[model samples]
Target: MQRKAPARGFEQAEFQARTQKAQALMAQQGLEGLLLMTEPDVRYFSGFHTLFWQSPTRPWFLFIPASGKPVAVIPEIGAALMRQTWIEDIRSWSAPAPQDDGISLLHELLAPLARRGARLGILKGHETSLRMPLGDWERLVRALPGLQLTDATGLIQGLRMVKSAAEIEKLAHICTIGSATFDQVPKQISQGMPLEEVFRAFRREALAQGADDTPYLVGGAGPGGYADVISPPSRRPLQAGDILMLDTGATWDGYFCDFDRNFAIETADDAARRAYDVLWRATEAGLAAAQPGNSCQDLFQAMQGVIAELDDQSGDIGRLGHGLGMQLTEQPSHADFDCTRLQEGMVLTLEPSLGYGDGLIMVHEENIVIRADGAELLTRRAPPELPVI
Candidate 1:
């Protein structure tokens, strides 16, 4: 199936509604303001997209008030780009200022709430972190001692868990691009090809297929099955009986589509073929179980039941799958510990893996969105049987 790329960026109304919803949640929690420092959070509210986040020399900030639009307290260099967003109040400073480093600006913006003993929320729970320097963070904390700093991991992750119609469009577009790239793997490489070159070829194909970037591409090739799923590509050459996997998190615009495919180099062994069959059937179970009413645990159990037939222990990787969006992985993890219920408009990856044959593991993944009725695949489904190159 072919899909034309959706329009880049988002409409002003998209950000406006997002901000309104965040504000409503903030008001319910008695949060005076929600402070964000990470790239995804800042980009979620204000469409301030840039690769400048790669540099650690400066820090950026966004403050979401309980009533109106969010404020962008950022470096002087980003002022022009931030201005293009729907944001109204864009505060700027000469960043990397050893003396102030935007702390003074943050203090002034948050000081009023300090006087009234108002609560402020920063993401402080699991899967969250402060992207700024620790010394600078301590300085800001010391400056605003009166402000009640609370953990807002739940509040923010909750708001971002479900994707909007516009967001889903971008997601679907990227997934299409990734799928097209994956389909070209057999033509790109075969036995005697170096694994590292295979990785390079994948990046080139993804970019040629319309992906903005393939920042996350890792897999391993080995006899029968791979040692593990997360190993970086080695310089070793592919050979007969080797199982090759390439898991990619290709991006278009700022959205990401994470999935992987497995191909047998020349031919596959009996053990590897059986493992692939189990994983494929497991994914089929996952596709059927992924519904609006199913919980993440329910989804996990459905796939786990199929995987357990061959291997009781799923791979070392903690969760089967996770929420997908701006970043590679998001909240509402598919695992026993996570009971987050599935809802319409929530996008996720159903990854099922199994261990077989003297510590070798095989993992299969696919991207999908939860519709009112069931799961709709974003990435093209892998073949039932592993392909031989």
Candidate 2:
């Protein structure tokens, strides 16, 4: 089925500014063009958005040269949509073809760059993966001989970390919606309700509160606390004295707000209450330390110092938090090993977790944008005390 493209997602000037920034980075890196195959990269530069990407049978490609407009090489089904974007060069072919698929077209687009001895950058690194199939990538590599393929992961990450004013506004709006939905938990949720039902109710509330979509929602419930941060909701009823945590990556206008809140079912235990306080204070420390010129590791340490005695459960949940923008999780992980500098305009999350008794854990998260003087909260600050339902 052919999909009609809506008008450009943002003003033309927004995309134009992004293109100029990317071109400047490409010039600094001595690269001729960027071969963007991921959804976020393609949409970021071209204002192209489609849920059609859910299928893996066909791959879409976007090429941003060192200068000038970007070119789109996508399936014919997406031609109408690509035309709606700022891109002018739209190359399409019948995709999912048993033999060719869109490989020939992609190779043709890159052949000229190869002939000119140009270095082409592709996103390949931590948290980044090739959207195209391995067989297709191998074939393209063989077809484009002498084309210098380099890791442009850093280049793309550097550009995406800083959110434009419009992007920040969208992010802040979604976060506000999420916070409102969470506010209804006390009234909407109750003891004995199944975890799965709680998940459904929370998602419905988010939608009712103006969320366009809820892409990610994972949570857990246990007597003292949850053992894992990313587990799917279970069918077990929410029992009294259990610590129930709900983490969501709710979206509005393609922008996502990633955060979570904890609720005590009926009553709370001393261990759970103390753990919540520790996590809350840790997040406060992170917020106080988040400013321009500070590194991500520095932020991690500040939070870690606040709860050093408590077992740091951040290792179990990956980084404390990560850069958030177009995707639910982006670059610049908030971990001791990550050295990415905290720059103004970067949107991030300060998540702090601690282990309580009986192998239980509690995680608290908040979203913020790095500002010139300090960090500005995106999501309304969660209540300092754990709210008991």
Candidate 3:
């Protein structure tokens, strides 16, 4: 017989606390149970972690009742991993079955709640995408009639928005590692280095500095500024007077730190320098305004007040910044329309962007945790002036 694997990830108590909190929310919302199909939600409540989610072939499901441990309906391939979590009522089926990928099993598991006229919750709102196939979801809906499906996006968002002490520690560790790597760019980067090589070196530096993974890395380099923020790196070579920005969503123990730093290649023009200064000031304004009892709109306005020619468009980058924890981007986006109140223990990023010369823009970002009195910075502060590499 093979030796059993030890339980990993968060402690049993942490998962229990999470389940209890989610249960209370479910009860308040009149939800009989929550059916989680996304990776973050399932892992958040069950402490199950796996990189196999990269493949979109098989869909995993977790059933969270109003007041008890969650039931994991996953594939047999993940049985060992699921067993290592705090969950005991594990139900496995041979996945990638093509015809029936755990749909029948999920229907059987949720049948009891449906019989009680209890509404089941699923995430189907803003910033959320159904993780399972449409045919399977439709089949499950038909399998259990009168089982009203409600949106649990708000409930899950509320629980994940605030960070526990342990989660905060993991995020801080990753942020520090990313900051250290950013500090080395001035020496490692040159005017003629290709953007692709720079990206590779940044990832290497992040791993060397103890980052578990560098999953999100996007940036651009241009003479005055970059046009798009989310574009992949091209083979374009850096030139004098170019402004380069690298934003990373590096992880430590599955927690992420989302921020970026800007650098000038050899030299920066007056327009670029001024734009950098404005962006830096905007970030400071956001940091000052991020505290308990404040609204996300308030933080957005505060940052927008300082920047010159601030554009609030829903383009490549939706909002100035958004809630960060457990995933690269969470909820309560810092946009003018969002009124979500900032509460203590919430981790967020203060990202402010402004247009520079014609069609070029510069952006600055920082990460912080909301506190009772004020905001506590997690990543090391960027220099007041953009460094010339």
Output the number of the TM-score-best candidate.
1
Best candidate (score: lDDT): 1
What does candidate 3's lDDT look like per residue over 1-389, in tens digits?
12222223678999999989998888888998999988898899988888999999999999998888999999999989999889999988898997889988988898887787779999989878889889888888888886889999899988999988878877777888888889888878898999999999999988888888999999999997788888899999999988999999998778889999999998989888888888888898999999899999999989888874554332225578998988999898998899999999999999988775678877888999998998999899999998888
Tell me which residue pairs clash in candidate 2: none
Give me the runs in candidate 1 sitting further than 4 Å from their true place. 1-3, 312-314
Model 2 — which ten-residue stretch has the worst lDDT?
A: 1-10
User: Each candidate's TM vs. the true structure?
Assistant: 0.98, 0.96, 0.96
Candidates in order have lDDT scores of 0.92, 0.89, 0.87
Residue 203's lDDT in candidate 2: 92
* Better model by TM-score: candidate 1 vs candidate 3: 1
Give the per-residue lDDT digits (tens) of candidate 1, residues 54-167.
999998999998788898899999999999999989999987787787888999999999989999999999999898889989988888879999888998999899999999
Overall local distance difference test of candidate 1 = 0.92
